[model samples]
Target chain A: MSNLFFVDKISTENIQSIENEEAHHAIKVLRLSVGELVYVSDGHGKWISGPISEISKKSLAIRIENTGETHAEKPELVVVQAFTKSDRNKEMLELVTVSGADRIIPWSSQRSISKWQSDSREKWMITVKEACKQSKRFRVPIVNNQMSTNEILNEVKTGFAIVFHESAKEKFSEISLPANLDRIYLIVGPEGGITEEELQLFSTINATVVRLGAPILRSAHAGFAAMSALQTKIGRW
Target chain B: MSNLFFVDKISTENIQSIENEEAHHAIKVLRLSVGELVYVSDGHGKWISGPISEISKKSLAIRIENTGETHAEKPELVVVQAFTKSDRNKEMLELVTVSGADRIIPWSSQRSISKWQSDSREKWMITVKEACKQSKRFRVPIVNNQMSTNEILNEVKTGFAIVFHESAKEKFSEISLPANLDRIYLIVGPEGGITEEELQLFSTINATVVRLGAPILRSAHAGFAAMSALQTKIGRW
Candidate 1:
């Protein structure tokens, strides 16, 4: 992969000027001269590539040789992650972003030890965007919504939903998706296990309760495990 | 699950005395009184659980109630993980431990940006041990000795080995395994990627080269992703 930088909005002009912090890092820190190849993305879907036309201390001009669109993965994978505070919070975001979760929902569970501040969502979005750029990912995963336990339970009723719990009798491997599915949701609980009321609510709705395996996994790590297992089982890996 | 503690050695005696930091945490910090239930493990495979007979600031005595043995998972899973420095190193260790990797080998890849110190392996072992406890896992995952590139390549000839590379033609989900295989090895490279010489060395030994889905993954997160994929494909998840 080539060196990829982020741009706010991309246009279809023959040449694009990068004047953001990314431009400063590329031109000043990286010290790329004209004619060196690099790539830039808006972190939406489109990316442009070609040699640099002009380089300066503040910005660089990219002579757009070709442009292409990177499509998101099919079936629209979503992870309803319970909020975990401190470093584990950032860890959950980084892992889900790099592991192919398309939409991440920060769910507030009753048993969650960590509470989400008002600015927490914005901080989470920043981390997700940077993670996408670091991984050279085009369709950046969205940390777009925060949900309550009841709201998430109601949300998963539309598509294939699997909750990862240690007490669940069924294994995650037993889940099989049907054809023409629109979405697949993996619900992760907090460090402290999901509360009895939350489990009852999900069970009342008849959501498929699944366990990763025999051993218990921490809440932050469970999301990635479930996502990977779902992707592999559905022939998406 | 009861509150589980750790002990270096266990026996068939009627009572076991808890000493050291775990005892301090349980007795002083957590305030466990007599007749309260708790569990203790050898950090190997054996766990004994019972009520507390004596509790003090220094130690606690547990009267042995019932002994149970937890066995290791079959068709042993091994991950050849390249050493990633700092916090990412612990992330790799935690993910693999909870995801059910039987043995983790810290490899010295040619393109590895991070170098392992003598104490690095010891710290890794501590993380693995803690991960096992946090996950309520019975048999702790092994953090074995380091391996050279050539040594690992030579060792994988007998078992099914797959190298995760970005440029590989085969997808990880596409591989088929034999029914009675003894082991499955997944080799993960570093952030700079595997060198040409290292790739050539593995190719010469006929190790199946494979790639995860389309997007690139960080060096730290790749091991868990590959292990989850393998576990799901092999019906172990």
Candidate 2:
């Protein structure tokens, strides 16, 4: 696989020049020579692949050989992840992104131990973007601003949502997704686990409370497991 | 959930004393006091949960209020993981353990960059045990010594095996597991990817070549994804 770099914009021109941070990464970090081939993605849907034409201190030109666009998946997979401690948050982002989550919402659930910072979204984007590059995803997952429990209740009303709890009586295998569903939200709680009151709140909105299995997974791990199961159930895997 | 500690032996005795390394961890690291409830497992199948009856400087005793045993899963889930760099190996161990891998075998595939150190198994066991405690799994996963390609070939002959490859045409969703299969091996390659020779060797043994989806997953994350999907398909989740 060719090394992929993110760019702000990708065009159909014969020759494209990459500069600034991404180019610096390619030239300095990756040490790509003038003739080496590489990939560039807009991190939405458009991408180009070709050999480097010229190398400079701050920029490199690529002779575009292939250009293509990947259409976003219908019924996008979204994750409403509760904030964990600083150490585990980045791991959660990488796991969910690699599992093909289309969007991610940082949730401030009742049992969450970490308070969302102003730069949390920015920090999360860096990890998500790196995961996208590692996973070869052209579409970078959107990380929404931190949402409160009430906001999550309102958000679940718009799409099919499943809240994973260890104590839930319902098994995820028994779920039957609607045929015309446009999006699905997978909610994971914090390390402290979900509170009873919050479960009641999601219950009132008819969001299904489902359990994965017997093993007690950490907050950083449950999202990846849920995403993988959902993707397999939806025939994406 | 109560914090769980691993002991070499757990008995039906009403009062059981936990000493040594596990006790030190409980008494010092976790700071448990008398009457504090916790669980103790033998790391095989038997476990007991109860309030602390006595707390000394180096040992803690449990009242053993509840005793239970977790039977090993039918069709045990095993991962044949190729050696990766040191940093990613620990992450891979944690992911697979939390995702409910029953056993793990280190493999030295053709493209593996890291050589198996003499103490690799011991180090891996420490990580796997920590994950088991975090995941609340009574039956801790067993980490086998590093095996060569020929050994892996001979091992796969006894049970079903699935090799995850990006270029494979067959999707994981298309595969059907055997009804009476005793064990299933999920093979994951290294960061450099699996060589054609290894794929061909596995294919010769009738191992199924399956792809998860379009997105390229890193070696550290693929085992967890495959395990989750497999667990769901087999109705374990």
- TM-scores of chain A across the candidates, in order, are 0.91, 0.98
lDDT of 1 by residue, B76-172 (tens): 8999987765668888888888888988988998877677788878898889888887777777777878888878987788788889998988788
Q: Pick the candidate with the highest DockQ.
A: 2
DockQ values of all predictions: 0.71, 0.75
lDDT of 2 by residue, A83-146 (tens): 9988999899999998989999999988899899899899999999998888888889999999
Specify the CAPRI tier of model 2: medium
Give one digit per residue, the lDDT tens place, for model 2 in B124-225: 999999988888889899999999999999997888999999999988988988799999999999999989999999999999999998789889989999
Model 2, total clashes: 0
Least accurate 10 contiguous residues by lDDT in model 1 chain A: A83-92
RMSD of each: 2.3, 1.3
| Alpha carbon deviation, residue A96, candidate 1 (Å) | 0.4
TM-score on alpha carbons, each prediction: 0.93, 0.97
Model 2: CA > 4 A from native:
none
Error of 2 at B113 (Å): 1.5
